[model samples]
Target chain A: MYLIITALAAAVATAFWYKNRLNDKLHLGALCLMYWGAALMWLVDCVAAIIAGEEEIIDTSLNAALLGICSVALGLAIWLILLLIRSRRNKSQATSINSH
Target chain B: MACFAAPLAEAVITTVLMKRFEKKEKMTDAPNESQAGIPWSRKLKWLNNLLWGGSALLALEHIWHGEIIPQFPFLTALKEPGGVLPMLGEIATVGVGMAAFVTLVWFFMIKIADARAKKAAVSGKTAETEPCI
Candidate 1:
């Protein structure tokens, strides 16, 4: 499950980077967010395993939910950021057009 | 039969819904304007429909087949209930996780599509708002 989450994270980050090549800043920022979420999931999974005293097997669902929450949060944040940027640009263009 | 059939049925439903959404998105982004047809909101509505349908399937499957709790020795000290509460909780958690994961994937798809559209919109410098606007 960790591998699944990692792979999904990688896929998402790659897609973001590829799609946003015109904006390297947004690409890196989104990638960092994904990686941070993945890293946090790994940390939580590892710590939970240690606390469980079950070194042989680790629970994947706990980490899965954590990662899911992180993904939703990051996705919403990205959507909001993009929307804000687009609206501001539109507003600025509208003002310029009006002035002209 | 809700155990095995439910998941497969849900998968079929999800596939149909996703394809419908894709079609809506395509039509919405087309150059030809046609507002008298299907509403544009259906593009995202189908995605939400998938999440709800998928969650229902996941919950039903988990309740019917999934284990209620972790196999921890300490937790096992508590008497297990033959009732439905344990299954409900487990299924609820799994369903929520599955739905959230799918929603995240849908968001990623939307972001990629939006980015591509934005790039296309800027490249030719031709205002193509007839369809989307």
Candidate 2:
């Protein structure tokens, strides 16, 4: 399920964020915010479906689970790309500071 | 079925607000979090990023389900005669709820950040000050 996958990503990001609180360079906090926001949205969706009797809570079919995994993978790939960009920016910033 | 549209709409409105704040920030200073109280635009940016990311994923999932299409009146639900009302109802309830919940969470984040900044200040690390000679 998208809910489980996204929530798991959020947990991992939250842990990393907690550990790296001293340094804001990684921007894991932002990553955590993104995933947690996703998880919350999915939660609301799941609840709404249940209340409406539209869908089951757990759709454990192979295709659905695979899709959820793919979505999470895509999300993480984007986060990694962002981290690389920020790190490069920070590096350039540090060089300018040193030159100054 | 078009529930994700709610947060996506919210994201558009927030993107506008964020751009306005960002322009103000640029006029004042760089987009630096090390600045006092962080920046309103930066704080708002957290919300914008979350909403945008979530909306993108939801939109993709919906598209995969063929609930959305790459044509006019993109939502398939809209194509059904007399489908407008039910789709609107879903958006009103689910979409609004998701947007409001995210906003509430953003408020909590702001509070936590403020508290952390205050603690750092108390520890003499948050601001630049001249030392006694």
Candidate 3:
């Protein structure tokens, strides 16, 4: 579920970025990287579990999954902060330009 | 549960990293350039799409496997026989498939953008520049 929600959020952001390609001031590309990195990490983990047999290493796989989820969450937090900072900076720049 | 704690920790780490990056961006006076020719912002965009597509595909697989339920405490459904490991296996399969698809699209987009730029250059016209929204 965590993976699903995070994925959906990333997908929505990507779509938004594409739609506003003409005026992509926010740099959503970073956000996409973070999400995709997390997804890939989890995917690798899933494969490891299958190759080893789930019953043989359930606890280990669970820990790995937890780690993957944490990384995704972290990526999201970073993206949000980046968005805020970029927007603020852009606003200030625009205001200065207008004043000049 | 680790699931709950992960997000909280992630938030803290993200905050620290963003602050560091912000300071660096300020110092350089080159807001877009961070680690070289490739802009950090653009890199993030591609990465974000890849993950989003992967996650979506994984979710769909989970739904097919009955690992995901629409009810309350949805995650608890994974506590069955094979447990979360099997679900992870499914996620891996679907995630890779989707990531590949997203990558292909990204490649095509880049190719198109490059073509447009080349065309503009040949015609002695300024390429359309992207503005911040």
Candidate 4:
């Protein structure tokens, strides 16, 4: 389910943030924030679903897994674009400094 | 039942506040090395990002599940007779709880970051990296 995927993303992102916290030119905070937000949201949804008893909480279906993957990919896609921009800016700044 | 709406509503308000605080911070002189710390606006940004990002996915999941519709009234729950009350109840409980929980977590994050900032500022260590907080 989404909760699981988001939680995994949050964990992995946290590891990355911890490693890069000191020299975070990549701005891994974006990844952490997005995944943590998503995980929190999905946690609420899972809890609500448990209360409503409308569906199984642990859905192992292919479609559900695919959807969760897509959602995570979307978050990663955004983070990747941010990283690229940051990288480009850093490169340009370095070039300017060298020229100076 | 549109539980994400509660967080989205809170995010809208917080986003406005975040912008105002950001503007105010911009107007102020930069904090000296001895006073290096996170601004109120930066702290608010943590909460704002969490709420906005979380709400987006929740809304998308709701739409995917057919709980939300593109048509008038939007929420499929509203189509059910006498459904408004239950839907409101869900929002009140689940939605509000979610927003409150996230706010609570953000509060803790700010507290920890503030503590670190205070320690760094007192020690005057550039290596402390308080600005990132």
All candidates' TM-scores?
0.32, 0.81, 0.40, 0.83
Model 3 per-residue lDDT tens digits across residues A19-91 = 7766666676666655654454444545556775776433345544554466556666666787898789889
* Model 3 DockQ class: incorrect
RMSD of each: 15.6, 5.3, 10.7, 3.5
Which tens-of-lDDT digit does each residue in A22-64 have in candidate 4?
7776777767777788788778767878988967876778877
Best by DockQ: 4
> What's the residue-level lDDT of A4 in candidate 2?
86
RMSD of 1: 15.6
User: Residue B27 in candidate 2 has what lDDT?
Assistant: 88
**Can you give the lDDT of residue B46 in candidate 2?**
83
Q: Rate the local accuracy (lDDT) of all candidates.
A: 0.45, 0.78, 0.51, 0.80
Going through the candidates in the order shown, the clash numbers are 0, 0, 10, 0
lDDT per residue (tens digit) for residues B1-133 in model 3: 0121222233344446556665666677773221133334443344344444344334444454455577855664365665677546544554344445445555675555546555655555432533222
Alpha-carbon deviation at A38 in model 2, angstroms: 1.5
lDDT of 2 by residue, A35-81 (tens): 77778888888888889897578677777777677767767777788
Model 1 CAPRI quality: incorrect
How well does chain A score by TM in each candidate? 0.43, 0.80, 0.59, 0.80
Candidate 4, residues B7-31, lDDT tens digits: the string is 9999999989999988877898758
User: What's model 4's lDDT at A4?
Assistant: 88
For B42-113, candidate 2 gives per-residue lDDT tens digits of 778888878977876777678878999999989999899988899899899988899999889889977777
Native contacts matched by each model: 0.00, 0.40, 0.26, 0.38
